[model samples]
Target: MEKITPKVDIAFKKIFGVEENKDLLIDLINATVAPEDQVVEVTILNPYNPKSFSNDKLSILDIKAVGQTGKRFNIEIQITDESDYDKRALYYWAKLYTEQLKVSQNYATLNKAIGIHILNFISITDSKKYHNVFHITEKESGLPYFTDLELHTIELSKFSKD
Candidate 1:
């Protein structure tokens, strides 16, 4: 029998965004995020629910979780190459990062937010690397200004079974 591809957005969300698959999600996050930013465990903040999208047609099935260290993780799978994919990803990342703070909460209380994008097509065509990580840094010094925000992109088209 053929296996269903988890690369599909719904399938991806269903597999990694469930409470029962918490361990699997944690392992996946640890493998995807930077070594220094790895997490021991993660709690599914927004667990997958098919009914949740039944009313909204524009909703993207992305997995949202919070790590033991308080860092937030958003995982998304894209099979089609949208024109404004980069901007859309950044918008989602920024939304998640900023939404951590309440009206009276301090900025320091905000936790690191990471967005991981698994793309079936080559989003970054300039590079052949399957895995890429982005961080805010000083241009001349090449030093990270703040490690609070991170974005990871995995090009499935560049992946090989070998």
Candidate 2:
């Protein structure tokens, strides 16, 4: 018997990036989402197939999908800590959000883009918690003003360590 390191980029992709294991993905995702916005089903946009994993182990292996509620989702697992990782998450979220609309599509047609980043390092030092959800809210009241954009950061190091 050998130890399987799921935290590795390719292993993580292989586990959750396929359509067959969508239930596992949905369950994991549901734990981080609100009860009202819980996802029952998701259509995987970029699925992983072992037949052609490519020679590159560091290829962009984000699990892209759309939930049953018309919300777009981008799930990425980062084992190696990178500089400006927060910005990278935001950039990916923005790219996914903006790409929904075309030259003729109405603004209202755009759905919510949710970015789920699983990091093996500590990104947000302010919070001691392992999981953090970000949204655009009112500064004074702290009420949610915008619900279209949501970002989730799950720091694995904090969870397994502290």
Candidate 3:
């Protein structure tokens, strides 16, 4: 593995985008935001490296931002046509939520985590609109659920402003 120095400044803006979504993101993570709760800072973790040196050389133009709400979010810009999209989304969501627990903190102290994947691939089925949210729950009772920890996936290819 070649050692690449992380250019923390320009890379951060490129991934997160200097747009209104930055503000909207703060609201999204906090669930509801007050008018005065200005988004003070945005931190991107080290694992958020855009470069992936796997089989295919590709960069994820995605943003992993943490806001004042103590919530972490993974937003990805994906353009791929594939099956089992729902399962793939779940995998990423779980990976983010579970990885938050530190050795000292318990589940109660873990901050709310979410993985938002926005894809621009055309759907194979009749389903047109693209936003999906997922949460942890039981199969049988289906009673216990965490309202804070959530996941959202949007298919941009099938979206319409109208």
Candidate number of the best lDDT: 1
After superposing candidate 2 on the true structure, give the runs of residues whose Cα lies further than 4 Å from its correct spot.
47-61, 160-162
After superposition, the stretches of candidate 3 with alpha carbons farther than 4 Å from their true spots are 1-41, 48-61, 122-127, 137-144
Weakest 10 consecutive residues of candidate 2 by summed lDDT: 49-58
TM-score of 2: 0.85
lDDT of 2 by residue, 77-115 (tens): 888889999888887787777767879998999998888
RMSD of each: 4.0, 5.3, 8.5
Reference-based lDDT, each prediction: 0.83, 0.81, 0.57
Query: TM-score ranking from best to worst?
Result: 1, 2, 3
Error of 3 at 20 (Å): 13
The better-scoring model by lDDT among 1 and 3 is 1
Q: Is candidate 2 or candidate 3 better by TM-score?
A: 2
Q: Which ten residues in a row have the lowest lDDT in candidate 3?
A: 4-13
lDDT of 1 by residue, 79-147 (tens): 999998998888778767876887899999999999999999999988889999999999999999888
Each model's backbone clash number: 0, 0, 0
Return the TM-score for each candidate structure.
0.87, 0.85, 0.60
All candidates in order of lDDT, best leading: 1, 2, 3
Model 3, 1-162: lDDT tens digits are 964322243443453555544665555444423343335665665443332346733323255666675676676655556688667666555556666666888778677667766666754345655776666688898765886557665666667788
Lowest summed-lDDT stretch of 10 residues in model 1?
Answer: 48-57
